[model samples]
Target chain A: MKRVGIKDVAREAGVSPTTVSLVLNGQSARIPDTTRDRVRRVATEIGYAPNSVARSLRTQRTHTIALISDRIATTPFAVEMVQAAQDVAREHGYLLLLVNTDGDHDVEREAVDALLSRQVDGMVYACMWSQVVDVPAGLPAGTVFLDGRPAGGGFPAVMPDDRAGAMAAVQELVDQGHTRIAYIDAGEEPVPIASRLRHEGYLEVLRRAGIEPDPSLRVEASITTAAGGVAAAGELLDRPPAQRPTAIFCFNDRVAMGAYRAARHRGLEIPTDLSVVGYDDQQFIAAELDPPLTTVALPHYEMGRWAMQVRLGVLAAPTENDGVHLMPCPLIRRESVAPPPAQHPAPAGDGE
Target chain B: MKRVGIKDVAREAGVSPTTVSLVLNGQSARIPDTTRDRVRRVATEIGYAPNSVARSLRTQRTHTIALISDRIATTPFAVEMVQAAQDVAREHGYLLLLVNTDGDHDVEREAVDALLSRQVDGMVYACMWSQVVDVPAGLPAGTVFLDGRPAGGGFPAVMPDDRAGAMAAVQELVDQGHTRIAYIDAGEEPVPIASRLRHEGYLEVLRRAGIEPDPSLRVEASITTAAGGVAAAGELLDRPPAQRPTAIFCFNDRVAMGAYRAARHRGLEIPTDLSVVGYDDQQFIAAELDPPLTTVALPHYEMGRWAMQVRLGVLAAPTENDGVHLMPCPLIRRESVAPPPAQHPAPAGDGE
Candidate 1:
């Protein structure tokens, strides 16, 4: 079948092609609403589709974005962020071309080169985990970061407020009348710095409760994996029964999963014996756990929207700003965390 | 710095621009090997990148593939299939544009229209599960199906060999001497025909071993989720002792996880107490379990490669073939299954 054109819609609607184009483009402010409606109805009847490639060539705008990531396309839950970005881009008549770099600098360079060749109008960089890394030098004019910021500086980054998320989680435990909460950090070589931010949040909350943060109560996780969470809990569990912290805050959900394993290994029941709180609120891990996981959730979908907006703005106006936008990390309450044991006094802590 | 162009590469290499172009495009067969190497080296050294968009317009080939997925991008391990496709596409100088439809016909139509407008050369439609779904009508001619087949066939499709995978798993159980093996199917409302295929493989293997498949031992999982798995195992475990099957073959990994939970709830240890086998080989669920899991792994990475090859093949030569290719699903032996109890006799039945 011959492809339908705007001319067909115009001829059928008894209108000029210019009027048909204006109506189809939603730029029918001068045209009467009735005319616009009729033109649209006729276009649908005739299957009129504006030749997008032809339009792109004329306008010098591909309306396509390149989302280059280490593994966002493969990582669990992280892909949701990409999907959210796709949804936003689609709303704005743009499609996303994702290039998985696999953390190889050479692969990243090739991916960028390939996307540039395809004429992607803008670019977004995503990392599975929030981390501080050097922005690729000489990026296209319109580039944005997701879940990370340039260790050095370049574009606007939308990262989860890990400090706020950790504070909210610890505060949840505090509200349940538990004062002695343990902080499980992402160890010494914390890549993202969220581990330190979250640790600081925990300390600040303890100080707010008028309990001096105990150095001994603070422990570092080996890595952000489940094994790390398990090891971090092992140290705290080693302490005498009454002396151990009543509750623990993990750096991420995987760490919390590790804590669950450690607790189960040591015959410790969750919530009943120990109140646990985690971050990242990874649905697959959080929802599938035994009692479910009460954790802090990052606004990945919103973050995606914000990143797309940043790229869109940069494309519209070539402006540069060294901005770090920390999106809110909301607290998701489930069954994992609860009040510490009844016999333990309110604000239980070491005899300082 | 100003962008380097073909003219610059020719000048830098002391060769004609035609020679540089030919070398860059791999049309350097007529050129001397040493001259070709020098031109390529000069191109890389001077950072000469061909104007891809202009070239695409000239060649009428975008060298871009659209990966339209229902939920593969949002799924856990299934996203790896996309990554595999991306890796293969990248090697062949193609970038992938991923659009998630979530099984909505409207969204699928929009995604296809948008991609067609962007001049994507081909498309691969992927679904998280292997099911027979209605192929969206009027899809671009260069399209292939992944993990699913068109209800009414036209294009090429690649699906997991679930029957072969199931037979292999059951045979492993049988080799270790299991006759009364239970089949926890995906139920009669199975969206993916793989469930039934796997169940059939199990029965066929049992019959081959001269064992009549027990009707009571066969149960169907309500859903493929972990909860569905747990429920399916619950019904099987409800039977009186000595009547229960010596081993169980779950529909998928999540179902196997459920069987693990049910076994634990009933004080039965995996392999030692009741040998359990699962399908899908989901890393998170399979690896993290107490004893790990022995399961059949769908060759998702291979399936992706197959889908990409099909699309590329169609683009190379517009040939028509109503083909459904079933890729191998290899067995990944972990710790979930083992020899049946020594006390049990050969061909152990309900009479035991």
Candidate 2:
């Protein structure tokens, strides 16, 4: 099929090509609405796509943005950030050029170079997980970081409020009247910044509740997976009946799942014999567990939108100290939390 | 900092702007290696980036490929297709323009129009799961379909071999000496094409093995979630001991997880009392299941790479009937499959 152009739409509408262009581009203030509607209808009928390449050269702005990510494309739920960024870019008449560099420096450099060559108006540097990363050299000004912070922070960064999220998770258990709560920590060495912050929040909540934080109540998982949760929860549940924790707070939903398995293996019922709380309300795992998990949701979608807004100059970068935007993490309550069993003593006329 | 230009590199390298452009563009065959090396080194040192916008205006080729996906960005594992396509496009000196429409037709139309205006060299219409869809009108030739086939069937398509993958999953069970197999099907009416194909594969394998397919053993889940699997698998497992299925094949990993819970509720041990298999070897769920699941992997990465190759003309589109490229789905063996318990004779000193 012949490629439709402004000339084709003009010929079909019986108007000059310049008139067609003006009407279609919304630059025809002097033209009647009837003529503008006719030109647009004719253009749509004939599929007359505007040549952005030619327009880009004349205007010197391609109306394109580059979203360079460190493996966000391959992860679950986190990709919502990419989707939000894309939606914002599209709303502003810009297309997104996406590049996933798999955290390889060489690939990132090449991707940056390619995006620069394409003359994208701005860029968003996103990470799969919240962390402190070294921003690559040669990134043009106006690059916004999402779910991460620059190591020597000056650029605008949007990340989840890990400490607040942790506090919320622990507070949920506290609200349920559980005093002896055990924590399964994601304890890889050089503990991740999130792990540290969440740990601090857990400690704060316990202290604020007037509960003495027991040293034996805290157990570290080798990793942050469900398997890790199982191993760590096993340790806490292995204690004598009097010392066993009534509730367990996990690092993330994956560990929470492991904890579920551990409880089941020991014939403990959730929200009955034991209560559990988790973090990172990851899709599928959080709401889909046997008894849906109560977790803290990372505001990935909000962070994504915020990052794009900063990059597009729709939202100004925070000028405060550290220049990081902390998006709130809300606690999602489900069926996994309840009062301690001791609070629900059996009636006097029961089995005995 | 002011953007460095070709002239800056030319001046520093002691060469004309045209010579520098030629060297950077890799059209410097006649130029001496020493001159080429100097020009490249100076370009790198001064950070002279090539202007693709102007070059595209002159060449009429934008060197950009648009990947339009239907909710792929939000799903797990399937985004690997996007990554694979990006890698291939990058290797060929092109950038990927990604747009996810979340299966909204209006959004899809707008996205298609925007990409068409941007003058992308090619496009890839990707679906999150394998199915037949109507190709949107006005897309240029050379557009490739990934993980889906065009309803009218005239375009190049790359999709997983669902039927073959199903056969493989069942064959693994047969190899383990299972005959009393049940299927936990994704039972929504007008079943998804993948479910239909996989179900056919299961029936074909049973018939080929001389085992009559039992209608009661083929239970359907209302949805393809882990919860659905539990409901459907519960019905199949609720039978008397003599009538119980020796194994179950789940529609997907989510359902398999449900089956796991169902079996556990019935005091059945996986691979000891019953064996199970699942499809879509989703990350975190499949491999991370307590006893790692044995499942089939949808060749998303391969289909992605293949689609890109077809888009880039690196590989020729199939000339045969249908023009759909069937990428093989590989069965990933874990600990989920085992010989039927009946196949093992009781030892002399057994519990009985």
Error of 2 at B350 (Å): 22
Q: Which residue pairs in model 1 clash with each other?
A: none
In order of listing, the candidates' clash counts read 0, 0
Candidate 1 lDDT over residue span B1-352, tens digit each:
8668899999989988888888888897898899999998888898787776667666768888999998744466778778888888988988999888878999888888887766788899998889888878659765788998888777778889888999999999999878779999886554558867898899889989898888899888888766777888888877886778778998888788789878877888888879999888876667666677899998888888889877877234223455788888999888988887766455647593
In candidate 1, how many Å is residue A304 off?
Answer: 1.6
Superposed model 1: Cα runs more than 4 Å off: A1-51, A188-191, A314-322, A343-352, B1-49, B187-190, B314-322, B342-352
Report the TM-score of the second chain of model 1 against its true counterpart.
Answer: 0.84
Candidate 1 lDDT score relative to the true structure: 0.81
Tens-digit lDDT track of model 2 for B53-162:
88897887999999999885457688888889998998998899999888788888888888888888999999988888877866677789998888888899988888
Task: Evaluate residue A331 in candidate 2 and report its C-alpha lDDT on the 0 to 100 scale.
Answer: 95
Cα lDDT, model 2, residue B99: 92
Question: Highest lDDT, which number?
Answer: 2
